[model samples]
Target: MPEKTIAEFSVKYVQVMDEKGIADAKLMPRLSDKQIIEMYRLMVLAKAFDDKALKLQRQGKIGTYASHRGQEACQIGGVYALGKNDWLFPAFRENAAFIALGFPMHLLYAYWGGDERGAKIPKEFNALPTSIPVGTQLLHAVGTAWAMKLKKKKSATIVFFGDGATSEGDFHEAMNFAGVFKTPTVFLCQNNQYAISVPRSQQTAAETIAQKAIAYGFEGIQVDGNDVFSVYRAASEALKKASMGNGPTLIECFTYRLSDHTTADDAKRYRTEKEVLEWKKKDPIERLRKHLEGKKIWSSRKEKELIDWANEKVEKAVKEFEAMPAPVPDDMFQYLFAAMPRRLREQRDYLEKYVNELRREKNG
Candidate 1:
């Protein structure tokens, strides 16, 4: 037989609004004015949270923290598109997702401060506490999605991870499983260009992360992660498809990280300032502000009011978080199981006695 190609595939790139605030009307999502502003507010709130968290880390009030600075559009836009019942599985650095899902900012602050109780998600919210290890949450999301499918539920499961995670074994396993099983899951990858010091170029040789989905028998689409409209539209569509039992989709949000990888790492060591400056020109919030300005619904006064409101809310949450009592070392032993094991009990008692002895010595 003559050589022939059986199949061909190409990834779709979505960008409803360009960095210059020019929007393609035909491609714009059918979002109302209220919904658009709500998306904008959520992004602003995420920025407020990121700013305060970074400052807290610098002042020694919080442990090492990740800043989702320039990727607010990706996080907030994708998360805001989720239905109330859709479960959200987030990797660490999904502050905006948590905020959009109505996770209390005070509890978020507490979590970053190293208190485990902060991550104890409320019963009403279907979000899982963000995992710190790369790519692991994808499996968990797939499992929940499979369960939903098994139960004939009408909700999808969405999982968020970074670009670096796509290279992990778990990413492939989850994608393959979800694809074979046709699970109602959405994989949201925030391609912020770098994973810590490693750039995206080093993470994978593939042209786009979304294309990886093709290998798993699913659809994958890339979107301008900095453009809120594109992110929201893609996520909304993917989630709807998942809930409707159409199987999985991968959304690779092409965004940039304006801040360092975390409070502890300096991005300037690896990437160029000029490169970052260029991405800053594509600032998501500013682009949205310009679009709103064109619509005559936003002005400097409104911007100021919004900023003031966001800052006030963040400050209030910070105060509430600080006012909460500190977590005891015994807290770890308290929550593990319904009944504490004898071995763990012995360890907890030993720790208590050692701590008390140290306290006495310091006092004396």
Candidate 2:
């Protein structure tokens, strides 16, 4: 037999709305004007939440916090596509997604304020608490999907992680398991150009992160992360396909992290102002606003009203967060185990004595 060429692969890139808010009629998803406006509102609210969180951190109201500034569409669109029954596992920095999923903003603030109780997820949302450890949540998502498959449920699991996580071994392991078992999983990678200080180009040699899915025997897609319509369309199709038992799909949302990696790290040290400026032009919230404006459904008055409403909501949440009782010192160690270990017991006893001594000295 002649040496024949092996199979070839090509990644599909989708963009329904341009930076100028000009939308392609054919590529646009089946969303009503009301739905579009709602999406815009959610995105704006998320941005407002993020801006406030940053200020709070600077004022010592919160601990180290991650910013979701430029990736509003990627976060909101992905979460909006999910059904109420579906499960979602999110890595850290999913503030916008959590907002879209009806997560309590005050609880989110508490979580950032270093209260573990804030992570006690509510029963209403079928979602996991934010996973801080890099790509580990991918495994949790896959496991949930596998369980759902065995139970023969018509629901899929979606996991959100950043580009840096793709480099973790857990990502590939999750991909392999999902591919081989045909689990109902959707892998959403927000390729936000850089992973902390490391650029995506320097992380992997592959042309695109979506292509990695091809190697695992599944389809992969790339989308304009700033375009709400495109991200929602891709996510909706993938989730439905998973529910229908079509296995897994990887969606690479090409977005940018306009803010610093976290409150502790400055983005300016690694990236240039010019690059940030260019990405600002593609701001997800701005683009979505422009789309509504082009449709004559949005006006400056509406924008002002929305802004006032969002700020008021955010301020209320901030007040609630501030009014929250201080975390118990025992909460730091006791919650980790059912029965406190000997070492922990000793540590607790010492802390108690030390606190008592301080109280006595203050009284004296």
Candidate 3:
């Protein structure tokens, strides 16, 4: 009888799925048919929300918004790997990730529409409020993981940040602390190749962002960011390790941002149309759709049905967001502190009086 040798090589970064729709049998995640279908549906819903948000921003319904257009697989795949008890600390561009984790679409839209209430996640969910300052949330995630370790909890923490954030001091500090303390955390960096107009080459000189984990004494792996299977497997493995007290793992999902950094920026000024066109060929949804087709489960009819359902859901959310009453000016002051400072209270009172006086004059 032949001795079963333990596999010594690293997992290949999955790219195209075989024509049979099975992940390379040796490198695949053990995903169920129901899970695959759910992943695909979530991806479609995310893309729809992104499109609608962009449209709303253009029409001035929302403030400047970021589109996670081509990076759905990376975001969804990474977040879906976590257990319900695990926590998520996200950067600004992870709309799909939050949505996949049960965040209401209307809350997300409301956040972009400039309502602070949008940042509030339900107590039942372990997601943190979205962090806008780049790289700052990494520290918070590390702290949470550290606390969990001290409390002897079984959960892990996942922090999502962009490649550009890797250059920040907070990123370094978080990694260093997680490594030194052996905290249960996974640092998921979505290296989408650009930070606003700045390309990855300009962001760092390292061969790969994941490789940076070596400096912190942890394992790191780079996976195809556009391949949901690869992203999920990598993240899941890292998360499993973290949950078992193996410390942190850095997983870099190599992907690209196919749209402008945000609605406020003009990507055309820095990137060529040809480059965007080229990346479009690597569309995450198309890869999954092709794989599903190969399995004979995905058809044009099914695709249309799913898309229509997603569109209707998005439209309904939009209506709900729009129907909410206009926010009061005083509402902004309410959350700034546990109790308003005297100066702010004076300003609030003065503004209220001024508005009332103006209304009276107009009525007269």
Candidate 4:
């Protein structure tokens, strides 16, 4: 056999299992058996919800949906690493992360189904509303962390974004401010190789996005985003460091986007089936499953149990979302301001009257 070789520049912060079902006993993060089982179940549920949402969009039951198929591990691992008090500022694509953080599945589906109530997360949860504008949430995370510092609170904020978002001005401004202020924040970028149709190479010329943090006066690390163990360990350490007032850290999770950008996108127009098939070889869930099986902690019976439970839960959420009463047209205008303006009220009344007149004419 040939001698084993290691790369000179390799700096893996933490990785418990390799893609080939190999385990690193020394580096694996300590997780109880119950915690491991829960993580596995959550990932399965996330994927099931993603699939059901796509079907709902196709059936006209929901508005455009973003699928989190291959990105389950990244979301679960990162969110699981947070303390109960830590705040989560998420981009629109983080359905799985929100669910992992205890956001109700019914509310999440309702939000995508065009209901404003879906945006109202319980204030006690510390999760912000899903931000549709790509990189804007980064700023919110930085601001929240800054506030915590001012209030002398011991909490850090984790903001999730895609590779394409790093090009946005808000991404840079947020990082710069966080570094300068030494705010307790973690900039977790899921570099899934493509930002919509744009490839990673076109997104930036930087060899590694994590290295950008070094320029901003903080530590930066890259990890296998698909490896749950890697993401959990890195995020846990980063959060701990921030809580200790050591300042912010940037973590680049190298993963892949296995599905179309959203229901509104056709990835085939820009990518190939062959590329997606190749990525399946690195499936995070499968890799972890194999490792668990090796430890005799996973079996066919457990797999079936989790799948059945997830499917039933998702089915129930769908029924609830569908049963919701249609939103009144006036609801759109009502939430825009605390008190409706006179002119706006007049416009709303006029529109309501016109709609009622049309309805009467049709009925007659």
How many pairs of residues collide in each model?
0, 0, 0, 0
Best by TM-score: 1
Tally clashing residue pairs in candidate 4.
Answer: 0
Report the lDDT tens digits of candidate 4 across residue range 127-212. 88888999999999999999988888888999999999999999999999999999999999999999999999999998888888
Predicted candidate 2 versus true structure: per-residue lDDT over 78-175, tens digit per residue: 99999877988999999999999989999999989999878878899888888999999999999999999999999999999999999999999999
Residue-by-residue lDDT tens digits, candidate 1, 1-364: 9999999999999999996675677879888988889888988989999999989998999899998899999988888889988999999999999999889999999989998888789998999996999999999999999999999999999999999999999999999999999999999999999999999999999999999999999999999999999998999999999999999999999999999998889898999999999999999988998899999988899899999999999999999999999898887677657999999999999999999999999999
> Where in model 4 is the C-alpha error above 4 Å?
1-14, 334-364
C-alpha lDDT of candidate 3 relative to the true structure: 0.89
lDDT, residue 165, candidate 2: 98
Q: Which ten residues in a row have the lowest lDDT in candidate 3?
A: 11-20
Per-residue error at 124 for model 1, in Å?
1.7
**What's each prediction's TM-score?**
0.95, 0.95, 0.91, 0.91
- lDDT, candidate 1, at 289: 87
lDDT of 3 by residue, 169-279 (tens): 999999999999999999999999999989999999988898788788788788888889889988898888998888999989889898899988999999999999888
